[model samples]
Target chain A: QQQVKQSPQSLIVQKGGISIINCAYENTAFDYFPWYQQFPGKGPALLIAIRPDVSEKKEGRFTISFNKSAKQFSLHIMDSQPGDSATYFCAARGAFGNEKLTFGTGTRLTIIP
Target chain B: DAGITQSPRHKVTETGTPVTLRCHQTENHRYMYWYRQDPGHGLRLIHYSYGVKDTDKGEVSDGYSVSRSKTEDFLLTLESATSSQTSVYFCAISRTSGGQETQYFGPGTRLLVL
Candidate 1:
């Protein structure tokens, strides 16, 4: 069974436009939500993360809006650039576990000029 | 890659053969993990090691095994390769300190089974 579900397996957006990717997890025990960005032939890298304590967190043009009550979180990229075009994955983790992470199926985001 | 390196960035082998992938880390992080990434399935943890000779299975531990004899090296072996095992494998290291946790991944190793 997939614990974390992501939508829009693929996405395309105009340069400088806003890009949003959404994900929802079933396990309420999840306390940490993180987004990872992966380039072709590379491993996923940590982009940004948010704890359940915060409703939103922003870093540069990237933002994560989290709704703990809804068990959902979304990533918003303002002024999406071609460099930001890559596979994005959302993950959740429980604090009590062995620090294992449950990742989403991934969303491929493309920013066209 | 946060000072992590995975050997054999790419490999091609036939089914029924044994295969091994190696992950080496420069930092002596106690936590090391092996995960496989497949389309429509995302990344799934296969196994992880908390210290030398101390390891545990993950959700997808079937058909795979791990060994960590030193702080810097973790090895994942497939007793007999299968086509279903054709996927990109990643090794990650984690650090838990000061009430915070950070995980970093290696470039990845692509394996193919015929």
Candidate 2:
């Protein structure tokens, strides 16, 4: 079973626009939700993350809106830039010390200048 | 940039051959993981280690075995490699703290089995 599901296998956004990617989870046991950005031929890096306790988190132009009850969360990139174009993934972990991470299929985001 | 490194960045092998992939970390993180990434399917965990010699199988453990004799290194071995195992393998590490499940991934190893 896929514990987490992500929508829009690919996305296109105009520069300076807001690009949004959504993800949903089926496991209520998951408490840590994180987003990762991966470029071609490179490893994924942590973009942002949120916990069940927070409704939203913002760091500069990146934001994570988390809805615990709905078991859904999203990543919003404000003022999107071509540099932000890459494959984004959402992941969930049960809790502390959970060695396994349930990852969404992935979303390839493209920013057109 | 989690101080994680994977060796044999690219390899081509034949079916029924034995292959091993190695992951080494410099951060001394307590947790290490191995996953395979396919075209349509997302990354699937094959095995993980929490400490030296402490390992467990993940969702896709078939045809794969892992060993962590030292905290800094984790090895994934394919007893008999198959074409079905052709994919990119990634290694990740995370710290053990309060909801601190942020994982740092290493550059993947691309394997092609004929």
Candidate 3:
């Protein structure tokens, strides 16, 4: 069973526009929600993360809006740039101390200049 | 880049053969993980180790085995290779286990089985 689901297998956004990627989870036990960014031929790195206790978390141009009651979360990149073009993944971990994280299918985002 | 490296970055093997991928970390983290990435499937956990000589299975551990004899080295072995196992494998490490800790990933090892 897929615990997490992501939308828009591929996305194209104009430069300086907002790029949005959304994810939903089925398990209510999940506590930490994180987004990872991956460049070609490289491993994924942490982009941003939010916990169920918070509604949103922002770091610079990247923001994660989390809706704990709805069991959904999204990533919004303001003023998107070509350099931001890459694959984004959303993941959820059940409770604290969980070893495995359930990951979404993934979204390939491209920024057109 | 977290002090992580995966050896044999790329390999090609035939079915019924044995293949081993190694992940080495310099961070001395207590938690280490092995994951495989494929198209459509973002990343699936294969196995993970919490300490030396201690390991556990993940969702996709049916065809894979792992060993961790030291704090810095983790080994993943495929007893018998298969075409369905062809994918990019990654190793991740975290200082501790919790909801807040961030996982650092290695570049990856691409394996192709024919």
TM-score of 1: 0.97
Lowest lDDT sum, 10 consecutive residues, model 2 chain B, at B95-104
> Considering summed lDDT, which 10 consecutive residues are worst modelled in model 3 chain A?
A93-102
Residue range A13-105, candidate 3, lDDT tens digits: 999999999999999988888899999999999888888898988999999999888889999999999999999999998766544788999
Given candidate 3, what's the lDDT at residue A77?
Answer: 97
Candidate number with the higher DockQ (2 or 3): 3
For all predicted structures, in order, the TM-scores are 0.97, 0.96, 0.96
User: What's the CA RMSD for each of the models?
Assistant: 1.3, 1.4, 1.5
Candidate 2, residues B2-92, lDDT tens digits: the string is 7899999999999999999999999898889999998667789999998999999999999999999999999999999999999999999
Error of 2 at A110 (Å): 0.7
TM-score sort, best first? 1, 3, 2
Off by over 4 Å in 1: A96-98, B96-99
Cα TM-score of candidate 2: 0.96
Off by over 4 Å in 2: B96-99
TM accuracy, model 3 = 0.96
Tell me the interface RMSD of every candidate, in Å: 1.8, 1.3, 1.3
User: Quick one: ranking by lDDT, best first?
Assistant: 1, 3, 2
lDDT of 2 at A13: 99
